[model samples]
Target: MRAIATPGGLPISDPAALVDVEVEAPQALPHDLVVRVEAVSVNPVDSKVRLSANPSDTPRILGYDAAGTVTAVGQEVSGFAVGDEVYYAGAIDRPGSNADYQAVDHRIAAHKPTTLSFADAAALPLTALTAMEALEDLFHVGANSEGTLLVLGGAGGVGSIMIQLAKRLTSLRVIATASRPETAAWAREMGADEVANHHDLGAEVLRIVPEGVDYVLSTHSEGQIGAFAEIVKPLGHIAAIDDGNLNLSPLKPKRISWHWEFMFSRSLFQTPDIAVQGRMLADLATMVDAGEIRTTATQYIEDFTAAGIREAHRRIESHGTQGKIVVTR
Candidate 1:
């Protein structure tokens, strides 16, 4: 089978030499579904890993989000068949989806939305799961709300979905941060109640959530989080996808809670609740089919290859995309 993998530590945006290799085909494992990848979406982590993660032993396939067809299933699998189209963000601990065919645990697999193209479905898994986990699992804000949640970097993939989810599932006033005018507009389209500049987070958030906000979800955990500590309500929660060495002392007075949403924790640890992803995916499919949810895909390119994958990575690195970028096979 063909795969785009990194055999050495290198930057993306020119993965032609890094990717584009022929590898042996994968075999099915118990409770695993072998998918013939039809589409895959790029995320920030893909670039970070391609540049930073060390794969000393062998080539590392580095993609998590994909939409494809189940060509084969392990003996223990029951919900899908050989021809059933599926979609999922493959587990972080295992091989990724930047390949001709890949194997994923049954638990993390979700049916593609009946109304969406493969590219659209590919964009949802990682972002939707992250957003859902940040609210429903980490903060206990599901189906009920006492205060508003401010989303930082709300024009990106996870943030875009988070804005819509808060609107769909909770009554929380959705305040989002976007530094650019186009991004601010994108955030609003995704259902942000208000948009503010991320550069002046404290002042901008104060204008919308005057009494401070209930939670802050940052897509990029860049620097000086303490500088905006005043904006979070006392006993509020903070969730983030990006993690760097940083201090948390300023949040002490507010009794602020912190959550790191990896989105791959269950699969990485093989947790007892690994099946939750599958259930969540099924629910999202249902939501899409019922017109309760919509795809966040911004760019949908065709085929899975070196040039296309490189372009997707470049788009993400440019940090200008308002929504998801997907490439189909």
Candidate 2:
């Protein structure tokens, strides 16, 4: 199998930061599926891990979002068999999806949407998992909703998918924040009832949704959250994926409920509830197949060559991408 890995913490440049290497083919575990990876998507976590989670003496693989075909299934695995198409955002704690073959826990994987291509399917897992975690696990706000919500970075990977989910799954009115004209338009196209600028986040949101929002999902900088406090409903909930030195003292007056969404939590700890990721992903797949949701793979750069992957990373770092950026083999 072919792979790209880093020996030390993720290197930013040169020195084969993400060098090509050949590794032994992975075997299906008792409850695992050996997938022949066809396409993978890059997320902020990919770069973050590249910069932070490198192995000391050996190269660490970096990827989490993948779509592929099951080549083999463990004896203990049920419900899926050889040649079953699947897509999953794997555990961050495990070796990633950036390879020719990967062994994934069947409990945390799902059948891919019959309508989407491998690259498009790959783009859904990570971002969808994050959004689902934020809404279903952390804040538990998507179901049976009766309040207005604002997705602070709704044009990004997680936010892009999140906007649609809120529209289709909940009764909540969604207002998404996007700084640029293009991004704002993109958000509206994705089902956002309204759009505001993240550049002037506080002012823009207030102008459109003056009464304050019931839920605020900040996908951008934590440093900008103080002003966000001004627009949150008095008893609203707030969730953020980007962590910085956030000074949340201002939120005291509002009595806001804060939450953090990391899709990897269940997988990282090997918790008894790890199967939730698999089940939730399956839910998303059903929605996709039913045409209730759309793929967020806005860009695709072919061939998993090291340079191509680097360029994909570079684009993500630029913060100008509309949705997910995929690298395919």
Candidate 1 has a TM-score of 0.96
Q: Summarize candidate 2's per-residue lDDT along 239-307 as a digit string, tens digits.
A: 888887777878889898888777778877888998888888899989998999999999999978777
Model 1 misplaced regions, further than 4 Å: 13-17, 55-57
| Backbone collision tally, model 2 | 1
197, model 1: CA deviation in Å?
Answer: 0.8
User: What C-alpha lDDT, on a 0 to 100 scale, does residue 247 get in candidate 2?
Assistant: 79
- Candidate 1, overall lDDT? 0.86
Task: Report the lDDT of model 1 for residue 316.
Answer: 88
- TM for candidate 2 is 0.95
Each model's TM-score, in the order given? 0.96, 0.95
Tell me, what's the RMSD of every candidate?
1.4, 1.6
Clashing pairs in 1: 303-328
Clashes (backbone N, CA, C under 3 Å), per candidate, total: 1, 1
